[model samples]
Target: MCSWMVSSYFGSILYSEMPFNVEIKAKVSNASQLAEKASQLSQSEGTVIHQQDTFFNCSLGRLKLRDLMDGNGQLIFYERPDCGGPKLSNYSISNTPDPEGLRAVLADALGVKGKVKKERRLFLVGQTRVHLDTVEGLGHFMELEVVLKEDQSLEEGEVIARSLMKDLGVREDSLVTGAYMDLLLEAQG
Candidate 1:
């Protein structure tokens, strides 16, 4: 079990204890084509969401405030390897009714690292969530997150993630190793 603490800048924060997932991210050459395949596989049109993610500097792991832009948001802290292909991510989330106020507190206390704004089309395929993201300044990408049950092993999650990647026509060569923030920071330099 990983142990960490977040300050009570936001009152009544919800916490999930060490939930993990096996996930992959890839650069999408054709957004519409991938969206069609994802929709077909899931048998439903995905939900469209606009997100503004503000990353804060943290000594351990990566912390970000995800503003859903619909009066709801999540403060997420996650730790995962910065490598290509399917990898395990251990994370926790806290829901907030007032994201703007929380963002201000976190930004001031931690200092801002960067921000990523994107339009995401989210699909549910079995136990997995397929995200078709159009990221500002970074183009389109597809992410597959296989949410692992408590009894599930990491290999099982990886198998599921790889299968979804194959189903979505995500090539190994197109796989990206890091978050959109890393890409944006690199582009600025």
Candidate 2:
């Protein structure tokens, strides 16, 4: 359960007003083992999601259209620092029924940057969302997002994230900075 409102529909678009989370991403060697541990810790089966995130060049922050491949999509704008440890992120999301049209329009307007396609296994543990992602051409990764409450301090969120990392056996050495898109671009160069 995220502290922020999931979405609000205005006209044809559903928006997630403004929310912040403390998060971290890490490289994982054994996704299955991590998934098993995450599932056990969460006490529930995880949901599998196939996502294709197409990024657009934005002057400030990162903008991307996420196509779920199920006829639904999300347009997300987020700003977070590139760091190995947990960091705060501010983000907004809008849901659109027509992703192709939106993607084309955004591409024409902002220019396409890169795309990341991944199969994500999502698990919820308390207020945190644990994502075990198998990214195409990248490899396995795990992300922990501690959705912060409106009144919560950033340090509180980081503490939660760090505890979850320990429980999941995530070592500090395996942490990665930046998004999958950055990794993809670096690989290309």
Residue lDDT tens for model 2, 23-134 = 8899999988899999999998899999999999998779999999999999999877676788777788999999999999999999999999999999999999999999
Q: Please, what are the lDDT tens digits per residue for candidate 1 over residues 1-189?
A: 011222122112223468878889999999999999999999999999999999999987799999999999999998776778887787889999999999999999999999999999999999999999999999999999999988897678888988888888999999998899999999999
Candidate 2 accuracy as lDDT? 0.88
Please state every model's RMSD to the true fold in angstroms. Answer: 6.2, 6.6
lDDT of all predictions? 0.88, 0.88
How do the predictions measure up, each by TM-score?
0.91, 0.91
Q: How close is candidate 2 to the true structure, as a TM-score?
A: 0.91
Q: Cα miss at 21, model 2 (Å)?
A: 0.1
**Local error of candidate 2 at 89, Å?**
0.4
Error of model 1, residue 8, in angstroms: 30
Residue runs of model 2 more than 4 Å from their true location after superposition: 1-17
Cα displacement (Å) at residue 74, model 1? 0.7
